[model samples]
Target: MTLNHFDDQFEDSPQAHDAERAEDLFVLLSCYLDGEVTPEERKQAERLLACDSEARQIYQQLSCISSGVQLMPVAENPVSAEETTAKVFARMRQQRQRRLAWGGTAIAAMFVAAVSGLSPHLGPNNQQFAHTPAPVSEDIGNLAPSETEPRSEQPLNREDITSRALFIE
Candidate 1:
């Protein structure tokens, strides 16, 4: 058969008259209440309500259930003020302890760096090097090349060194 004939047959079928078919009317009514039903569904629901009192009653019952479900009281657990305060205090203490630990680690790192910097200067092995005497003038003379030998001329002094010193007469 053609599509139109099949639609007519389905509409006239015994199954379509069953109470289970009222569920469609309930769904349409819920969508209507929620402002979501399409124009075609709204027209179909109106036609059903005008033609079938049972379908209309079912739609009304579903709408009431929807509204009732939305209005029902929700249960909430009771929390005391003292309990909330204690929770806040505990969180603050945890944060404070973390900050103190990080600060202490930074301070310890700085101290280690300071000690490392001073270690080479103050170490026991460095004492002998620090106390060693200056080389004898004759030994320094032996190590130097002869000053009478030809060498590059020194750059002239830009300023006299004695000019910086003040001697009171």
Candidate 2:
């Protein structure tokens, strides 16, 4: 009935009845009570329950405690329905603010992309400048003098002279 009675039952071997072991069992029981225990641990606990009467009784007592703890009524808020609605509205407003912030960021990114895409066509000043055709120059005479009509026949090997001329230039 009492935790002390449960404590006394396992006092012969205090090491066997470690608080940590009980706490581990309590956690397992909590998971079991919530229907969240793994299949393996659940099977092990069930096997232990089948073989040991004391273990079963202790489990039953703990189960009673668990159920009692779970069934205890939670405290209700003192706030009126209007106040609750106000809190809900405030939360909605905060959520909307967050969404708006993300939306603004997306819009800014899109605007930047649009501007960058248009940059080459828009020129340096972001203004559309027309492509003007370059003016063509009138024909000019040959800048170099004619070789055959020249006076100095200094036995110029033309190929070697041209190659040397290219390097000299």
Candidate 3:
């Protein structure tokens, strides 16, 4: 196997343990800078930062990153709250007017369709309807009455009603 430039003879050295500790220290430094660490953790990070060059370097990098992010621009809308609200309401009104216009147009189209469909029967020259009433004969009063018809306009009693009543068992 080809050995790299930094390769050393020792396989079981303290470098691996130090690398893990450095990673933990980086996290501790980041938390400390963000003010997320507790009092005990803050003291631990401070002690590490004071004694360890790697921890101090990580803290400096984290500090720079945090400050750089804070310096970045966050866009703030220029329009006033009232203006934005008015614009939104205006858009809504426009939509409502459009819907109403479409609905009215649909109703008018349906009305025209109905009128066109029924035009043949409702035309001026159609002979289905008659203006004058049908002629009635004068002999209607003189015609003979059936058994179901009343003989006279006399007031009916219980006995008279029994004569015409059909009973079901």
Q: Please name the candidate that would achieve the greatest lDDT relative to the true structure.
A: 3
Model 3 worst lDDT window (10 residues): 4-13
Q: lDDT per prediction?
A: 0.76, 0.73, 0.80
In lDDT terms, how accurate is model 2? 0.73
Report the C-alpha lDDT of model 1 over 1-169, residue by residue, as the tens digit: 9999998987788886674476666677778777788899888878887999987788788788888999998758767889999999999999999999999999999998788767976554565422333334666556777878887788756354334444432
Tell me the tens digit of each residue's lDDT in model 2 across 1-169.
8999877776757786676567666666666667888999898777767896655766888889877998999879678899999999999999999999999999999998888777775445556435433433454554456676767867878775554442311
Regions more than 4 Å wrong, model 1: 1-20, 75-169
lDDT of 3 by residue, 45-154 (tens): 98988898988889889999999999999779678899999999999999999999999999999998888767976655666633343344578864676788767987
| Order of the predicted models by lDDT, top scorer first | 3, 1, 2
TM-score per candidate: 0.33, 0.32, 0.38
What lDDT score is found at residue 33 in candidate 1? Answer: 70
